[model samples]
Target: MSDSLFRLDAAQLAELIRSREVSPVEVVQAHLDRIGGVDPQVNAIVTVAPDALNAAKAAEAAVMAGEPLGPLHGVPFTAKDSIDTAGVPTQRGSPIFRGRTPARDATSVARMKAAGGILLAKTNLPEFSYWIESDNLLSGRSNNPWDLARTPGGSSGGEAAAIAAGMSPLGLGTDLAISVRGPAAQTGITSLKPTHGRVPMTGIWPRAPRRFWHVGPMARSVRDVALAFSLLAGPDGQDAFATIAGRAEVGAGPQSDRPLRVGWMVGPGFGPVDPEVVATVRAAAEALATFGVQVEPVGIPALERDFALDVFNRLHVMEMKPAFREATRGHEGEMYRMAKTMLSLPDTSMADFIDAEQAAERLRDGYADYFSRFDALITQVLPIPAHHHGADKFAIDGQEVDATYLQGATVPLNVTGLPGLSMRFGTSRSGMPINVQLVGAWHAEATILHVASLLESVSPVQGLFPNI
Candidate 1:
């Protein structure tokens, strides 16, 4: 029962706890034990919440007392180190902020707790949460559970690794470009990057580029992600960007009367993708087609004209560099690869920044136009499967590309403030996970999640967990 408890998703745990079949303490202890046993190899958890068991005891009391329960009542959840957890060290994955504990939880974390979820631990991330890999000066690095030699994917890599390894069933991760989704893809888990502004960013780091930053849920199942999203979304009043009031219902796919329309693409705008990755995207589209959904291969002209990655780089660097400079002012010696790299990059020229802004608008317009005809889009989450640690260049499908190429299909969503779900749908020949991105127009998280649930039912890689 203890071993099986660690394997259950958050929803399942909640059901068991509510039914008195499993005590909250038992469920939380199982995950804590799992972390103790698995984290040494994964290096995913940075700091376990000292009061985790105590919180579980309190939750158990609630169940015993017959108190009203929240949706995630008694389930344990982990968060990236970059997200604040009151009294727990948030360190931001850098030595400069080591031992820095926040006085309050981030809006996402607070909401999770409010829903009766236990804060299990804080996960690892790259220095300043800026890289695509989760290595940092303070907590070392995180390895993919699927292949220890390869990375889980960065910034939110630790959260992804933890959930994949069964250390935590549900977790919170922030995505600027590919932090949440890329890591989820590499780890063979499911993650949701809800429409921008859907979740508040209060108490999270690197808020300078707040427009692109998003806080969302990473979990083992699409329904768990959807459950977490429903609880996490809406205005907290503290974040000016989180203007959407109340919890927006996760849409129930396309209206029951009409079939959903989806477009699948892998190139031209997103750069050269590996053949396997392309095949995975095609398979997802084909699966949707067989489900009676309108599926077609399509391209967005604006993405071809104004590459979203280039636009993101220009706009973000100008805004993000200042925050990095301010944070690392006196602690430059403690900085790691990503911070140093970001600091060394040239600032965008005024003219170039303006051009990039226009490009971003164009990208948004292009997505709007696409959504006008299609309800969602399908694309490869990464150009290739998880790569070895420290790899910065790759020969993807005969084209030499930099590491940033991994964000090709993902950055456009950030640029357009759209929502996307990343879930495992295929496996590479080498046995690594290959995930496809499910994209929805702004505020259409429900629609994408609905489609993702459909894909989840038909995914060829269903119930496949890492051998770890």
Candidate 2:
């Protein structure tokens, strides 16, 4: 019975705990036991919170005492090391800040705990949370559970890997480019990259350039994502961007009766895409259409120019480099290789910055125009499935491509501050997970989550688990 406990979703555990069917301690212990059994092979978790079991006991007492329970009461969740946790070490996968523990939890983490969720552990990530793979000088690399030789994607790879492998039922991961969504794609799970600033960034590392950064929920199901999102959203009085604009209902909404017009694409648009990935995305669209969604093939002309990636590169290097360089000043030698490389790049000139900003405006307008016509746009989360470990480049249908192309499909949504949910659709011939992105207009997370819930009902990867 304890062995099967890890297979239950966050909602299931919460329901059991609420009805006194399963004690909180049992649920938390099952995950800890699972982590003990699998983490040596996966390397997804960096630090197991020492107080987790004590908290679970407290939660159990609350249940027995008949105290009111929060939505996720007694459930356990993990967080990418980039996000701050009050007592747990948040090394951010860099040796420079090893043993560093924040004074208070990040808004998202604190909020989750307030809702009765226990902090199970801290997961791995790229050094300084700056790259697309979770490997660092501090905790080592995190391997995909599906095939130990492949990557789980990043900078939230560890979060996705932990959830997919059943070490944790839900988690919080930060997204800049494809950090959250891409990893969710690489691993066979689901993640929500809420509209930029929908969640607070108060205690996260390298807090400057708060524009593109986002803190979001990742889990085995879209319903869990929505449940976490509802708790994390709204102004925290710290993040100016998180100001309320009126919230969108998640599972319950009037849009269910009306057919949702969704635009689907697999391209010549976001650079060269793997053939299998393209086929899987089309199949996912068809599955949604079966549920009465108005799914159609549509192209965003600006994406064909690959302007999204270009814009993000220009802005990122300009905005992030200085702060990163300052943070690693004397500790440069201790940082990850990618962090050093990013800092050594040439500075962006005013002319290039202006040009890139203009291009960004165009990309935002393009998505705005598209959303005006369709309820959402469905596309590939990554052009390819999880590539082998240490691969600097991968081939798509016999053509070689740079590793950075991993973020091609996801950067546009970041630049536009649009919400996107990356959920499993199918599996590759090699058996790696395949995911598609459901993008909605700014602050349309509920709409996208609603659509995703419908997609989840018939997901090809639904009920599947990694053999690990």
lDDT of 2 by residue, 317-342 (tens): 88998888888999867877888898
lDDT of each structure?
Answer: 0.92, 0.89
Error of 2 at 378 (Å): 0.5
What does the lDDT come to for candidate 1? 0.92
Error of 1 at 58 (Å): 0.6
Give the C-alpha miss distance for residue 193 in model 2, angstroms.
0.4
lDDT at 149 for candidate 1? 99
TM-score of 1: 0.99
Model 1: per-residue lDDT, tens digit, 281-399?
A: 99999999988999999999998999899999999999999999999999989988888999999999999999999999988998899999999999999999999999999999999
Clashing pairs in 2: none
Q: Among these predicted structures, which one has the highest TM-score?
A: 1
In terms of lDDT, the best-performing candidate is: 1
